[model samples]
Target: MPSAPSVRSPLLDRFGRVHTDLRLSLTDRCNLRCAYCMPAEGLDWLPRTELLTDDEVVRLVRIGTMRLGITEVRLTGGEPLLRRGLPGLVARLSALTPAPELSLTTNGIGLARCATALREAGLSRLNVSLDTLRPERFAEITRRDRLADVLEGLRAARAAGLAPVKVNAVPVRGVNDDEIPDLVAFAVEHGYRMRFIESMPLDAQGAWDRDRMVTAEEILDRIGERFALTPIGREGNAPAEEWWIEGTDSVVGVIASVTRPFCGTCDRVRITADGQLRNCLFATEESDLRGLLRGGADDAAIEAAWRASMAGKGPGHAIDSAGFRRPARPMSAIGG
Candidate 1:
């Protein structure tokens, strides 16, 4: 006879966004080749067998939702859409106890094809990473000529009733920095919020020129001329400086990870597709939870492991102030 499994109680952050908001990376695979993110050359991706099965992920999330007050879940990937049957997984994760709010972050290339199914399956919201709206520039930035596809996907997501969708613009100084105002305008017209994130040192394998970095404060200053920007409050779990323009319907957020560090309010945790628990995105160390999961550890065992990982989290990363060099892991390695 099989033994009964152990259970973990609900978890919460200091900011109260339920520490259960799991960033479940489905695969370390992506199709786009953005200069700021994935490498131009092909990467050595992990084998398929090494990935967590869809069922396994759903089960883990379900347990978290039931015991640990997990009310929100965001599915990310090297490109989440690359993983087939993703909507099925979304449906599964959406049906969890009290039910988690299901959302996803995608480059939007494959989203047009999957948006309808995703909406039907219980996806509540979406955040698309769109740096440029120009066709040629889109190809130049992402190393892929799929701007049309991404735009179509955005339309589909909106039509599917995934309201309040977000667009993330990672401005890398001279690269897509000019697109900031364009993105803000687009967000205003479409009723979606756009977040401008300062480039960080997550791209380990590639050369990360911190000198080419553009801080969130700079982005806000540039756009302040067109729209009157006012500070907005968050639940405190999010690290972005939120501002809303009075006349426009859109909201702008600045993720000043490099300039204004918010690690003190860092309460989120990341779980790789293979189950390695990462305390901080910029931290070099991570704890192994895959072994424990595969060994049939009970819920209490899993909860204890989560607590231990949380305890090990550093106060914050010093790459910005300490003049530290970039780490070895790429941005893709750190999910969306």
Candidate 2:
């Protein structure tokens, strides 16, 4: 028997979780070929006709924020920077009457050129994926030699007044695990927040092994050796468990999605670049919002579609359950 839904909103799930954060993937094309993310070559890009136009994105954001009470919206991508007219899209989203807070997650390769513009267009913050600080290791991990470009982009993001600039690193065991200390040092030196994430099963190659993951405890134990860590009580629905380094005011966070999943408190929903609504990152099924949009459906119809999809969200992603299977699409296709 399920509990009653929230009278205040329709976004509330059966478990009483109110979905507020929306991760919208702007594109499914990336410039780099990270080994864990996608293949080195021969990837088929989504047809331009299928992608949601900037106007379409703005329309959905309006419906989400105004009708559904979504409070925060994070723009993501294969690489969001790859999308044209993105700042304009940001401006439109920021103009909503009760505009939801807007942020972006990027590979940081193109920020150096557009960080100032993005900030001016009303992007509030940024999370850049930076797996390794070593130039050689960076090249090895991403299969790209643009580490210096990414570093410059991080600096540009900070200089452009993007508050709380954070770096997200997915440290694999025996891959970039040894560079955690150095990565921490780099983040501290640059006054950026650092978040270490346990590698998930979203890899393109489908070769992820649970035993190979560097668990949250392992990350904390390793970093604790260099700096005294004081755990900070995480706020509601935040996936990361943050800590403050003793003596240094800088903070670090670990998103232990694999070891200790936060699906119970997850307040997020994702919309793929192709306009599919996903209730969970590892959701086996998707609801097609594109059909509603393209079929001349009204706002009410779109909202109804959203509510219907979210109503079916399960207790968790079931990654730890027996006979668990990975989603058909990889992280790049699913939007990180």
Candidate 3:
């Protein structure tokens, strides 16, 4: 077992970036098989015994918030809603001292049923993945005919008062690219903030191609044709470049991870469901926190290990570089 450092500090990389946001994956088991994320047949899910218990999760998060300087916690997953006792987990994380702001990103399959429970349990925000407006197109992209369920989930999230319900849409060039305008319109109509993300290279099949991605410029142009867009610029460490939809008070955002990488100001770090810490989303390397957590390591030791992992973070994901390589784990396994 490693001993704790004499002095502790915030999670900082060598490049001078301070990580305050934690994307904690509840489970790697998702209900949907989105083409960009998972295979149609689904994945070989992690064994139940391998996953961090609810108690283990709370302990790590406590260490992150009380010891380190984590101010925000985003619950993510293959689908967070699939995690049993989610409301209880959120309540526990919310009760932390210093109390990190809590949010969740989910496929929205079962959100309609539990959005209120989650909100009452202290979840403050939500981001639901809805790739297209058309049911057939949605089925085509996700390989599941559950568009109605997702839409209802969004509505339920709104009803539960999870304000500014953000909708995340990934516009694949030949697939849902044409629905960009409609997607934005739907968001605006329903008082949801729409976010368009470029298709990344994290696809399980390793079939991502730059040419096949609908660039940010193209996405803005598509929305521009119908709605007037005024730039709202970007806020601190946020991955999205937002814009006001001119007439309405609502805003739309685009996460151009490929065309416009924001690694320089990144303050986010991720922990996969099975307890591996990833300094970067596109990282090919990971540090095992599970071993330490289960092997009787002290809290200070865990914090020290976390700091060491971030120390090795590179300048960026380097997707545009010719030498760039996709991570061994797909988006589903790694946590979106």
Candidate 4:
């Protein structure tokens, strides 16, 4: 390997954004096969040896926190709950000096059983993916009949003190877009923050088409017809543009990642389950952090490799451009 840099720099990309958040995927294996995420048959699971051990994950997170100035961490997965002893991982992360504001993004399938345990272990927040409110539509979109379980999980999360729980909805043009008002109502009634995200090109089945994506503008327009929404500005590095309801304290957000990319202010990076570090979710290339971790390299060398990867990050993901191409890995493998 080339000589290490004289000093380890913070994870700053060429765009001048200092990254403080890291999305760490514990496993690429999920329980539900959402239509936009994977095929009905599911994916071939990775071998046990290929995944980073719990120790390795904690070590990398410590390096990111101590050496690179990352102050936030989100544990994601094909389904993070699928990983064994996840609470233990959360406890270790919570014990870090200046412990990161830790969170998790899940499908809410398994959360009902372990929500209390995870909260007790120091998990602070959660974002659950729920596309449709109707049971039939949920089954149709996700190819799973576990909407009841998901609802139970949401309640469990709230009861466990995971406050300000958020719901992430990806509205497809002809799919769940019609349920926007209903979804908003559900979120408002349940005291959950709902954000509509435009569908991106990360499906494992390669079925994403621009014509089928429900844009953020369309979502806001539809919601406006039903509710009085006043535009509200969001705080630092938040991917959503929020709006507060006129009379009520309820609020909604829209993540226009496709129509209006937030790459300029993106303070986030992702590490895949196998240890590949990606500066952007739609990146066509990934740096192999697993290799260095298992090759007897010290923390400094690993940090250098991470810095090298972020140094080349592009200005934007360019999803609306003609030259755009979807990544080989799907959203599940890349984490939420």
Candidate 4 per-residue lDDT, tens place, 243-269, comes to 997777789999999898888999999
lDDT of 3 by residue, 1-336 (tens): 334434436789999999999999989899888887777899899998998899889988988887788899999988889999999999999998778999999989999999999999999999999989889988888888999999999999999999879999998888889899999999989999999999899988888887889999999999999999999899888999999999898999999999999999999999999999999999999999999999999988899899999999999999889899889998888887
Tell me the spans in candidate 1 whose CA falls farther than 4 Å from its real position.
1-18, 321-327
lDDT winner between 2 and 4, please give it. Answer: 4
TM-score of each: 0.92, 0.96, 0.97, 0.97
Residue 19, candidate 3: C-alpha displacement in angstroms: 0.4
How many pairs of residues collide in each model? 5, 0, 0, 0
Candidate 2 vs candidate 3: the TM-score winner is 3
lDDT of 1 by residue, 197-288 (tens): 88876763566787788877779877886789878865467767788887876679988887788777665677777777776677677767
Alpha carbon deviation, residue 94, candidate 2 (Å): 0.4
Tens-place lDDT digits, model 2, residues 1-336: 212223336487778889999999999999999987777782688999999988789888888887888999999989999999888889989998679999999999989999999999999999999999888988888889999999999999999999899999988888998888778888888999999999889977787877778999999988987888998957788889999988886999999998889989999999999999999999989998888888888887788889988989888978888967788888887786
lDDT of 3 at 295: 91
Model 2 clash pairs? none
- Name the candidate, 3 or 4, with the larger TM-score value: 3
Question: Global CA lDDT of candidate 1, please?
Answer: 0.77
- Weakest 10 consecutive residues of candidate 4 by summed lDDT: 1-10
**Full candidate order by TM-score, most accurate first:** 3, 4, 2, 1
- Give the CA lDDT, 0 to 100, for residue 165 in model 1: 79
lDDT of 1 at 197: 85
